[model samples]
Target: MPQRTVDTVIFDLGGVIMSNGKPSDFASRFPEADRERVIEIIMGPYGQDSDHPWHRVERGEITMEECRSLNRDAIIESGIMPILSTMQPQGQESSSTGGISFNFSLSEPMVQLIHELRDNDFRIGVLTNNVREFREWWWPLMDFETVFDTVVDSSEVGLRKPNPAIYHLTMDRLGATPSRTAFLDDLQSNVDAASALGMHGIRVDDDPSAAIAQTRLLVQL
Candidate 1:
């Protein structure tokens, strides 16, 4: 067999390995008219890591409760709180905490692909911009230790995607060179960041088939 150009594969968790629960997924649940604004307030600018409440939470600088308080204040100030309140179900009580919940399921095809890559001796890792509070809920969805060589969670590491430091850190953990690593993420900005750093970055869409195909090509699998 010819030499493979890529030996390490890095994945973003929420939209790539997990079927749902991305920030966009949460925004999608809101009415179309309010979706974009809701996403902006709840997730901030995803392409850049700043002191936004959500970003701070992901970096472990703030607890989820504090993030929720900040979100509530922002929402109230935006005057959208009343609109959101009116959208609640007639019988259901509104939650005072401006918190978002995520329910995610493993992406079977991605899981299978990971196992195949492992069998082929390619290193696998996860680099996710995630909340500390969400670990318990999403951790059990996969046999992470058995599949991935390393799992880098932003909250635990105090860094998130689009911040070049985290990507460098992940590659360092895997003992991987940027040119020999393939990174897959559902967000274009994250993918672009990795690509800018000389990693072969693949953008995953709602349907992951294209991204998987691209990755296979990159590693010559």
Candidate 2:
């Protein structure tokens, strides 16, 4: 494959190469009876904003109890019955499992592509807007040191996407100059932020196949 100008590729973990299609897609997996309500509770007007429980969870500032409280409040404010069935407690000391559990299953194709990139001498890294406790769920599934040259978890650094500082941190850690790095993210704002820093930026869409195609096109792989 012909090379693009970028020397390093930075991917957002959730939807770029992982099997998570979209955050809202999970609502469809619930029982039909709970579908509408769950979607409204997790992906509706309150769902998209930064003040939501999920947002706070991703940021790692709030405890699990605080997340549930926020979730309950979001549901009630949306005129729906509150259900804490999917809320999981935060912190290692807690033994509750009422909140959503995040799972990141890498597609075989993505895994192969990553391996190929490394074999071809490309530097790879991950910059995700993940919870502080993300390693509790991800470490067992993937090799951070082997699969990625560097990882900048937003929660660990206290800087989330659309914030240029986070992206700058990633570039610094990866030793990649902005002109030599390409960033892929599920959100347009995140991509735009990367672009502002002089990196090639690609927005991942809902379809995994489409996202993969976009990645290949951008990388010229």
Candidate 3:
């Protein structure tokens, strides 16, 4: 492990430290879909100031229940649902996905790594674009009190990632600065957001061991 002058480590929840718990079938709905296309159609393109239903849910302006209903209506009314319905939902893919996966389980390796970081005095935090019902399912993954010093969930904060405000808020909660924090996420766009603000953005996807190694490299006691 290589040591750096980092005081805090911020991680995204869904794909980084957790097995992205999306219904395996939902992902296979569009086998040939490109990442960009999936975002554009599923929840509008990535960026701040989105009126997309997912954004609204993350912002706490709408509930996840409402977002799902709205999504189905829009897809059906726009004739997108007919096309989607024809495709059979297959097994899940291991590649990067720009959307949120509601089904998540804790990764033991990640949990151990986090505990080690915490024990070493590195402030640990989680910045996730999660739904309102997140605690119900995610709490069992790890003991939040022992592992995380702060957690900024989009649904409660009315802010989401790739947006500058959320990043600032997270750093503020951890009492760290942009340069002193190391951020990790599965999405390039979210990583870019953190990088733009001077945080070390470590990207992880598909392969957990490689991702963990990358994190350990930057985080040495």
**lDDT winner:** 1
Q: What lDDT does the true structure give each of the candidates?
A: 0.85, 0.69, 0.73
**Across residues 31-97, which tens digit of lDDT does each residue of candidate 1 receive?**
5437768878888998899999999999989988888878887776766543343323455542322
Better of 2 and 3 by lDDT: 3
The C-alpha local distance difference test score for the whole of candidate 1 amounts to 0.85
TM-score of each candidate?
0.90, 0.76, 0.80
Q: How far out, in Å, is residue 196 in model 3?
A: 0.4
Tell me how far the alpha carbon of residue 94 in candidate 2 is from the true structure, in angstroms, after superposition.
Answer: 7.9
Question: lDDT of model 3 at residue 189?
Answer: 86
Which residues of candidate 2, in runs, are more than 4 Å off? 1-4, 26-53, 81-99
Q: What's each prediction's clash count?
A: 0, 6, 1
Q: Candidate 3, residues 77-183: lDDT per residue as tens digits?
A: 54433234322235532221222333456777777788889888899999988767556657676777666999898888989998989999999999999888899
